[model samples]
Target chain A: MINEERTKMMTRLALYETKEGKKELKITRYSPGDYVMLQMLWSFVCGTLAFVIICVLAALYNIETLMTELFSMDILLFARNILVIYIIFIACYLMFCYSYYSYRYGKYKKRVNAYILRLKELYKHYVQNGNNQNM
Target chain B: MATLLMMKEKMKEIYAEYYKVIVPTVKAVVAFLMLLAINDKIGYMARLDSFLVVLVLTAVCAFTPTGITVLVGLAVILGHLSALSFEIALVALAVFMVMGLLYLRFCNKDLILLVLVPLSFYFGVPYVMPLVAGILCGPVAALTLGCGIVIHYFIDYISVNALTIQGMAAEGTVDKIRVGVDGLIRNEAMFLTLISFVAATLVVHILRRQSMDHAWSIAIFSGAMCNVILNFMGLLVFDNGPSVFGLLIGTIIAIPLAMLVGLLFMGLDYSRTEKVQFEDEDYYYYVKAVPKMNIQAPSKTVKRINTQRYHTNQK
Candidate 1:
């Protein structure tokens, strides 16, 4: 059964190789908010991972190459540099996330509110019969 | 102010009129420059490295189908590699085959650009491709962009380090292949560009969809800024990169190119936002309208100027 399911998945993947198929295969059950949320969530994870990995690599470079020649005196400085970079990365990433989320939410909220008002107006008109039809 | 606005509208009309021809021609130039850059950097055959040949082929490509251009360009590169050596040719062929497989799987209109973009970057003409991709393509195109960067950097890394490559070749086939694979993995620039393009694509994609004034311009500017800043940060962290002034100059050039991409894809006028409310038997509907901004194609209707002829015949 597992093998059969895997085969089905593989077949679907192959089928969606074409442009039309890919477009047809979109998971449109979610709202734009959910879509954006998923996008940001993945981006955040990827960006954070990238920063951590690069900083680790930088630290490794410092230890393996610069430490033997420059000695223990600069160790504190190297560590400080890594900390500063990581802080900068965090600050920038946070700012971007905050701005992007707020912008999306602001517009989404406006549309949703407008929809609610329209629905309320319709309900009011129905309660008043044809006298308030224009409402 | 009214006159200036009128002039701007007129200019937009003229721009839209020739956009079809212009797009293909620009793509052709980009393709030609990319092919030439690859040939100059990595080609083995001196005879096939002629400027006229690439120019003619690219010109023909502009008129022909996009697939034809891609095929011809690949064939030329393969031919050059074969001239260099059978082993290297085989290596390049394998690379091409894999990319071709991926292309088949994606089956996208970005087939030509999926390869050409990274090659263009390798030549220091990176401004156009990313901006164009960001302006026009979806988030999924980032995957193709990543693939392009890997192939470009891999091939470039091998071509530049002849001594290491030749030494590895002397050892054995397995060693040679290992060296190529290792170089690809170790390439930091490739990773940086991949990240930059992906981020830019996402930012532009989202921003362009917003129903707001100046969204396109904002998207273009921000996307360009993101690409420049990301690449700069990557270089600073990983390797010795271009100096600050050089970077600044490149960014300056890039913004306008990005703006051009924005203009080509998004019309000059803002798409007016509309809100409407309606009620059905079951429920009320609130709809937001966004209009597509495009120019109507020029159409012709012929009417004979026969009034004078009819008058003369009547007389």
Candidate 2:
């Protein structure tokens, strides 16, 4: 006789393991701070690269005018302005990453905790059936 | 109504029975249409303009991940733009890079919105994107749709100015790039559409989340109204937005399509709603459960009786 409850529990566990459980298992291995920091670093790199692409495109668009104004241009002021914009842009992007990854970590933690609870319940059922298993 | 529901059930049954084949077929059809639209809009490259090439690419897109289709679409667009001018292609690449790095990374699942929005605009039913996005997605969809609007305008600009850009070939590379970048930046119509669509998406998203009867229907209608009103207002003020008549016609056509999306995705039978209160160790939950509008296909029984054999046995 198959135990309907055990079968249902096993099915649920198997489904989770295949779906979100794959990511959640990996996520739970890291501390929340570490995960958020890692994501923020990624965001910073992408933001800087995108900013450079935009700046290059803008320079190319104004190539003729830039060539003429090259001698008279206040190079320091222009550099400073670009730097300020980059700083502000990357700061905003990093903050967004921080919030998003933090929220994800919290959610994944809750799911992992629930999965552990289900595993414990399954173990208790086995123990009641004279299976001396230690998790 | 019952007959329609029965048909829907039967169709759903058929879909479930042949899901694997149906999915790839639908994907192929969609990819084929999108590629054809691209070629029609900006087929500067002679090689990619052939029907056989599109069919081959569509076959490839059908079996791969959906993101592959998006990548292939981008490649086709770039190929056409490069034929016109390398600078224009570079400008497009930069814009796509910015959109991808900043906005798209956060919500990759909504990438299909990028393709659908431009395609809808080509079909003159652009208003459906925001309405459908509002019903099905969250606020992030507004940003994705905005990116789509930008792409449509970029393609439109290139198509409209292909001759002008080609005529300026002897002027210098700087002039061509400047014209391409400036056109995209100075496009008031694109900005207007972007703002209106984003607003409509947010309105629909908010309204559909309300716990009321016919909320999705109300949300879709209100979203359509918001889109129409905003576009009309922008047109009256800016005088450079989409034509008033086209805007009106598109919104009128979009309302029913949006309703169909809502019904298919979120149709609920509210008459059988159940409200229950339960308490657990940490919290008390007040839940309202509304069943989905589903009609199972009725089963048929065919019983065969051999009367001649029965008569022989009796004899």
Candidate 3:
């Protein structure tokens, strides 16, 4: 008395819901632009923090030398060089995040669309079987 | 060969049927081993070094994602280092944060390599990681392998210099941090290992991606050879590099282990390859299909008749 096709379809849906579907479904909640932008923003913040940590470590490593050269060192030039490096680093990080998240969003959207179609098919199966009449 | 293949088929069947339980159990075992190894290397923190603490953490790691294991391992490393020297712990934390926030965010799965490469070294089979990484992962794994090598060297440095580092507790915090950072960066042997590992991984990944018969085998062999040659060269160039005997023995052990891992992941039947030409609307397509070497375990069903019924029928 079981509908084999329905059973198979339901199983597939359940498996998807457990696996990658968990992440992909959440992606579907956001517009593609928003999702990519959010990712870029997050990467930018993390990248900046990482840069600052590296800078602090470098400073700590050369503290003795820096202390000796503190008065003699060209503060403006040092600031400019660090700024330039920071700009280049964040630029590369943001660009990568942008491209990666954009592609990922597109792929997830395509998958979620397929999943929706399968859900519709399952609903149709239920309707055709005269079950879940309210649906 | 036949028996091996049959055993592999049986293993595949068992794995397929019980993978849900198997994966977590393997995670738990690996976590436990890793925690024990860490404690053995540097058991500065008595509380974290306890067997009960490790078992509880291992149990949690079994149910959590693999990345959680890497984080737990990192936390344990920091705990031990902090107990030994607070400044060194800060230095280690900074390095980890840079790696995590900058690189690992995009490919966090590679975090496991941070745990694995060190464990492999502890087990005296260091070459397995790069060889397996090359076969199983993309080219980007070279970077991850390099990072893992750096981490291994850092941990090794910490354990070896724990007493000296503790002696520097009266020194300025910046000086201690500088010493810790210098110890990591100035290691010529670490640099050599990093170069060798990265080179081997790249070679394996590149060769494996080629469209050729016995590609995995060729890749594994070539990768192993590449690792040995690079390490040999490193030994000659660097005054203090990895032990030559360890290099040879590790490669000897790694070749077969990596090959076995490759076989499990990709068992292709190159002899049964099929090359066909077809035309699409836009262009002609020449495709080569390679079959996988998959053998399902034989299922035997024994049917028994009722003894009394059989006897009556015979009568």
Candidate 4:
């Protein structure tokens, strides 16, 4: 009886080991809040990059001279002003991104901590069951 | 009373999960209006009018919940009206605003790239390209004229007007020819806008699904296809004669075209590879372990044995 119980516990432990190996296959759904923050950060980066690239090309090609005839402002000044405005906009956006992510990460950590506690309880239960069988 | 309480609890859980989705959707609507206001295309009054429209629509959709079936219908009508008012800026703003708000509300930042990618295309293709052409044309024309004058002094060809070449006219035709041209321009703009909207939506939908691990491509494709169908229906009702056959054919063509555009323009499948791991120390075990067990366990067996059994025992 003792040997059978020992063998059973060993088998169960082995099963758990195999399960652990396959844990990555588990589908973890994101909380919608986290997903949105990440999306915003991505758009911010892409938008800024695009704005920067366009500004650079406009400067390099001296596209402003083409516009000076049509518009009141000098091409170089207009480009400079637009570039400055975009830079400020991008800086503000980055600030928003940092604050938002930090708050979300904090919330996520709390949820994860609770999850860990539940798992620890399950682990305790499995251990107790194994010990009872041994007795 | 007990059942009611349980139902309330269940509703709360659903709300918790859906809150992210709802917040962003509402925010997007608000932001789009704000953008319009900033752009001066829509006055405060118009923004207020649209805000009320969106609010009413939201309330109706929320109450019916099943009204999602009609979302595309509403979007089409509003989108069309907005476009007619030359409020494309407002519409674009609304799209991004809604997308941004939703991203913030839902915690889906990665999907923003989906919005940005298409936005870049929209701005790049329509506005930037035209501006570039306009800018470059003068210099090129000047160079050509200068060279011609230097080489062949007798050869004379005055450059075509930039505004005309750029397709901008101060005064349009007022007679039958005017009507025909107006009709053609309207049709062209509508078609282009439809294509652009569909393309953007498709790109976003594909990215969203791939990001969310959703298996509802059919639903999304159908929804997008429905836009063209709805546009045709609007045309029949409001504008020209009813062409049911044309509507069907347009939908058939539009669906594939939108999909093709989406596939070509849609960026990386980053969502597939990017894993969002919760780093909380306390919940780490639950997040990492319980979900594994819950998933690995025969799903049906766990649902039947654990949740149902627990409910029954409690009862």
Tens-digit per-residue lDDT, B1-315, candidate 2: 566567665555566556578879988987898899999999999999998999899999999888888889999999999998987898888898998888888767788888899999888889899999998887788999999999999999889999998888565788888878986788889989999999999999999999999898899999989998998888877857988788888888899988876665554222333345543233344545343436766679899899999999999
- Decide which is better by DockQ, 1 or 2: 2
The root-mean-square deviation over C-alpha atoms between each candidate and the true structure, in angstroms, is 13.9, 8.0, 9.4, 22.6
Cand. 3: chain B TM-score: 0.84
Q: Write the per-residue lDDT of candidate 3 for residues B1-315, one digit (tens) a residue.
A: 566677776666666556678889999999998999999998899999999999999999999998999889989999998998889899989988888887777666566777788899999889999989988876767777877787788888888988777777575788789778977789999998988889999999999889999887899899889889988888888897988888888899999999888876653222333345543233344545343447755679999879999899999
Output per-candidate TM-scores for chain A, rounded to 2 decimals.
Answer: 0.52, 0.89, 0.86, 0.50
Reference-based lDDT, each prediction: 0.62, 0.83, 0.83, 0.38
Tell me the spans in candidate 2 whose CA falls farther than 4 Å from its real position.
A130-135, B1-12, B267-294, B298-315
Model 4 lDDT tens row, A1-135: 233443433333334434432332221244546555665678576656655544443342443464566476677986698868887877776676666655655565565555556566546655665545434
Model 3 misplacement above 4 A:
A28-32, A106-110, A113-135, B266-294, B298-315
Taking chain A of candidate 1, what TM-score results? 0.52
Q: Choose 2 or 4, whichever is better by DockQ.
A: 2
On residues A28-82, what C-alpha lDDT tens digit does candidate 1 reach at each position?
A: 3346567557756754565566665444433433443555666646778867987
Candidate 1, B140: how far from true, in Å?
A: 2.1
Residue B208 lDDT (model 4): 42
Deviation (Å) of B190 in candidate 3: 1.9
Which 10-residue span in candidate 4 chain B carries the lowest summed lDDT? Answer: B151-160
Mark the regions of model 1 whose C-alpha exceeds 4 Å error after superposition: A1-135, B1-28, B51-56, B163-171, B240-245, B267-315
Pick by TM-score: 1 or 2, better one: 2
Q: What are the fnat scores of the candidates, in the order listed?
A: 0.00, 0.60, 0.69, 0.00
TM-score of chain A of 3: 0.86
List-wise, what DockQ does each model earn?
0.04, 0.32, 0.29, 0.02
